[model samples]
Target: MSVTETTVSSPLPPGKYYFSGNEALAEGAIAAGCNYYAGYPITPSSEIMERLAARFAGLEGRVFIQMEDELASICSVIGAVWAGAKGMTATSGPGFSLMQEAIGYAALTETPLVLADIQRAGPGTGQATKVASGDLMQAKWGSHGDYQPIALCPWSVQEMYELTITAFNLAETYRVPVFLLGEEAVGHLQERLDIPAANRVARRHYQPGAPPFGHPDPAGVPSMPAFGQGEKLLVTGSTHDEYGFRRTDDPAAHARLVARLNDKILQHRDRIVSTRSYRLEDAEIAIVAYGFTARSAWLAVDELRRAGKKAGLLRLRTIWPFAAAEIAALGSSVRQIFVPVPPADRRPDHLPGNHHPGGTGAVAWPATWKNTCARAPTAPRSVPAAATAS
Candidate 1:
C-alpha cells in the first residue's frame, strides 16, 4: 500500500507505517535528508523513483527528475551530490549495467551518493521480473579500477528501510558511492516499517579552506565541500590532488589518490561492514547467504537446529568491504561453510565473502535449492576450496 493510503486507513503516526521495500527505501532516503533524486524507471527498483517523485512534488528544496536513461540517471545523481545534495537513484540489472561507469566516476571523485540495485536476473536483460543476487560481485567490481565498494544487502522489507538509511550514512561518511544491493522480492514485499526520527541520521561535515580530497586526518576520509560553498571545489574523474588539481602523469599523485580511495573503506572495514548471526555461537556448519537467498538459509538453519545439528547462519548485511574479521571468527568456530549461490553459470567472478579461508569448507549449491541443508550429493564443485571459512 502507498503511504498516502496509510493515514486514512491505518491511522499510523509518521514513525510507523505499512509499505513495500521499495516504498520504504524512498521513505528512508527522504528521512536521511536526501533532497535530490534522478533515475530511469526499471523493474523492481522503479518503485523507488516513482515514490520519491511523488514525495518530492510537495516538498521544497527536494528535486526528483526522471532522466532519459540509466546512464544519465546515475550521472545526474553524482552531479546532484557534488551540487551539495544527498542524492540517489534506483534500477534493476540492465539499468544497473549502464550505471557502472558513472559509479566508477563517483568513486574516483569521492562523491557521496547512494545507488540501489534492486537486482533482477540477467547477463543482458535475461529476466526482467526474476529475483536474483546475480549483481553481488558486479556491485563490487563492475565499475573497475581499485576503488573500494561499500555495499549493503537487505533480506526483508524492514531492513530495506533500515539499510537504505545506513547506505546514505556510509556514503556520506566515506565520501563514496554506497550501494543498497537489494533483490526483486524484497523490493515488492510488504511489511511494517519503523522509521526513526529524521534528525537521528548524521550528515557529512563540510570544512571550508580544507582540501576536498586531502586526508589531513588518519581516518583516510577527507572533508567534503559542496558546490557554491566558496570552497573552490574542482572534482573530476581523473587522478587529482586534494586541491582538485589534475596529476594523471605523476605516479606519486596517482598512487596516493588510489590508495586513499581504497584505504578509506578498507581501513575502516570493521565500521563499514555489518553481518547478522543466528545460533552461531556453537555452529558446526554455517550457511553464507544474503539478499533473497538468506531467507531460506535462515529457515534451513532453524530446521537443522531442530534436527539436533549445530547449524547456524551468517547473513551478510554488508556485502562489500567484506566483513573479513567476522568471517575469520566464523572460520575458527564452524567446520563447514555452505554458500547458497546461484547456479554455476549465473555466479559472479568474485564476491566480498571470498576473503575468508582455512576453516570454511564451502561448497556452491546449485540453482535447485530446497528449504533444507545441502542435498546428500551437493559438494566439491565450482572454484575448488580447501578447508572452511577462515
Candidate 2:
C-alpha cells in the first residue's frame, strides 16, 4: 500500500489549520478544551510536546511546562487538571513506565485527563527509533490494578488527528484517563489532516457555575468546575466516595469506589469501542489485528480473497475494552483466526502447532482456539494457506 498525500483546498480558520500527526495531536488537545500541557522530551513522542509549546506560547489562559522528568511531568498535569484546567502529557515506553504509579493515581481519583504514549520497542529502552507494537500489554496493564481505561490506537496520520480529540472527550465524559496509543511510524509520518473548524470540535462543558462533582446529567459525568471557581473540592488517590474525599481504612468504600471506576468504562464499552471491518459478510477465515499490523493484515486478506479464498480483516481502533463481541461475531463463521505477531525479540511460544511454508517465509497459526472472553493462556495456532492465499 502507498501513503496517500493529504490535500487542502482552502486555508484554515483563524485558530485552525491542517497539520501532521504531531501537530494534529496538539490541535486535538486544544480542541478538546485542554489549556495546560506538562511533559518531558522523548523520541517518537516529543513532537506532541513541541507543537503544544509553540502553539500555547502566546495564548492567554494557557500554560506549558517542560518538567525535569516523566514522573513530575504527569504529576504536574494531574494537578493542573484538578485545578480546573483540561490537562495532557506525552511520553514513550520507558517514560510511560515511570508514570505508571501517577497514572494509577489519576485513575483512582477519577481525574479526567488525556495521555499519549507514542510507543517504541522496549522491555526497557530497547530501541528508541525502531517501531513496534510491543506496548499492547503495557497500555492495558501498565499501571498495576483492575481499572479500565479508554485507549484508542491510530494506524494512520488522519486517525492520529481525529482520535486524539475523541480520547479527551472520552476522558471528560467518563471521568477517566483516556490514552492515545500511537506507534512511532504514525507519530513521525507527515500527512495532510483536514482539521475541523473550532465550532465543529466537540468539547465537554461544565454546568455554568456548577460545584465540583455536582451531578449535571444522567451520564454520571459532571460538568467540571475549573480551578478557582470558589468550589470546595477534595481530590485524593485513596479510595473515595462520590464526593472525592479519601476513605483510607474503609474496605466497603474501597470496594464500591473501585467497582464504580471499572464499571464507568466497561458498562459503556459499546460507546467507547470501535473497529473497522473489511469483507466480513462472506469470509470463511478472518485475521484479527490492530494498529500498524492491521495494515499488513488488510493487504494479506485482499490478496487471499483475490486467489478465491474467503478471508476478511478486523481492524481494532479501540484497543482497551478489547472488542470481544465484535471479534466473536466475526469469528462465528470463520474456520480459523490469524493473529499476526510483529517481529519481536520475545517470540510468543504458546501458539497452536499448525505451519505451512511459503516461498521464503513460513505462515503459522495456533492449534487450539482460545476464546477472547476468558483470560486464557496464549495457545499455539495455525494459519491455513487459504487464509494467506497470496
Candidate 3:
C-alpha cells in the first residue's frame, strides 16, 4: 500500500533552522497542510521527497509513496487532492518534462496541486548537478493546450519554504496547478529559514450538489467536490458542460471551457503575479532577473551603486502571467534594462526592443553572461558599460 507506518518526528515547530531549498520546501509543504506526497527521486530535488517520506511516516492521515516514475508521481498527487488531501510532488529537469502532460490534465480538471521543480542545466541531461534557469519557458508552455499556469521562482532557501506554502495557497484559491521553480544552486544551498508560529492557508471551496466544472462568472473558480463526497463527479480532460456532460462535438462548449480557464488567471493576474524592486527608485539602468540569478543580480546592483552608477534590480517572484506590467513600468523610468542570462543562452532575438516570442512586447533579455555570486558585478558592468560608450 502507499501508506506505511514508522517511528519518526512530527512536523517541525516554529523556529529558525538551517535548511537546503529542498528541505525547506518539504517543511513548507507540511506547513501548508500537505498530507500527501508522491514522487520519484531526482537529483537536486530528491531531498524533498526523502524528508517527506520520513515525516509522513506514523503521522495519522498522512501518505507518502514512491511512485514508479514522474508520470505516476504527478497523477497520484492529482488523485490524492481529489480525495480531499492537500498534495505535492518534487522533481528536477527531466522529471519535470515527464510531468507536463499530467500538468495539462490537472489544469483542465481544475485540480489543486503543488509541483516543485528543482531546475538543473539541461536540454537533454546537460548537467544534472549544475544550475540553470532554462525551465522558465517550459513551466508555462510544456503542456499541449491553452491553459494558464502559476509559477513562482524562489531565489533563496528562505523563499523556498515560504513560496511552497504560497504555491499551495494559490493552487487551492484558483483551483489550478502551481509550480515552484527552484534552480539547482539554491536547491542545494543551505541557509537560515525561520518558521513562523502560524501561517494562513487557503482551503478549496466546495459547494456540494452544485456543478463542479464551469463557473457562473466567466472568470470565477467553480466549487470542487472530493471523489467520495457523493456529488456524482465526472472529471475529464475533454471539453464538458457545467454539469460535467461530455460535449466533444460542440464548438461553443469547447470555447467556453478554454476561455474560463485562461480568464480565471488573466483577470486575477495582478494579485497572482509578484515582484520585488531593489534600488529601482531614481535609477537610470535596471536589471531584471529571477531564481538564483536574482541573488547574483542583487549583488551586482550593489556593486554598481558603489562604483557611482545608478543600477537597480527587479526580481520576478512570479514568472508566469509573465510580469509584463512591472517590466513595462521599468521601461518608462529606466534608460536601459538588462536581463542577465546564462552564458549558454545566445539568443540575441530576446534582446531589448525585440518582441518576446511569448508576445510580451519588448521584454528585454540580455544576450549572455556568466553568473555566480562572486562574479555578479562583472555581468552588470560588461553590458551597460558598452552601451554608455556608444
- Which number leads on lDDT? 3
TM-score of each: 0.89, 0.82, 0.91
TM-score-wise, the better of 1 and 2 is 1
Cα lDDT computed for each candidate against the true fold: 0.78, 0.71, 0.83
Q: How far off is model 3, as Cα RMSD?
A: 5.4
Tens-place lDDT digits, model 3, residues 1-80: 01112322326777889999889989889888899999999998999999999888857789999999999999999999
Which runs of model 1 end up more than 4 angstroms from their true locations?
1-16, 197-199, 343-368, 371-386
Worst-scoring 10-residue span by lDDT in model 1: 1-10
Per-residue lDDT of 1-390 in model 2, one digit per residue for the tens?
A: 011123222123434345667777777777666788999999989989998898787667889999999999999989998787789999999998999999899888777889999888887888898777777667777798778777888877778877877787777777788888888877887777765554233344566554344243323555555557765667678677666677788998777667767876777889889999898788876877777667677777777777778888888899887776665565456766677655652344321112111221223444332322122114545544433332
For each of the candidates, give the backbone clash count: 8, 19, 0
Cα deviation at 237, candidate 2, in Å, is: 0.9
- In model 1, the clashing pairs are 357-390, 359-388, 359-389, 360-387, 360-388, 360-389, 361-387, 361-388
Please list the residue runs of candidate 2 whose C-alpha ends up more than 4 Å from where it truly belongs after superposition.
1-19, 198-219, 345-380, 383-390
TM-score of 1: 0.89
Candidates ranked by TM-score: 3, 1, 2
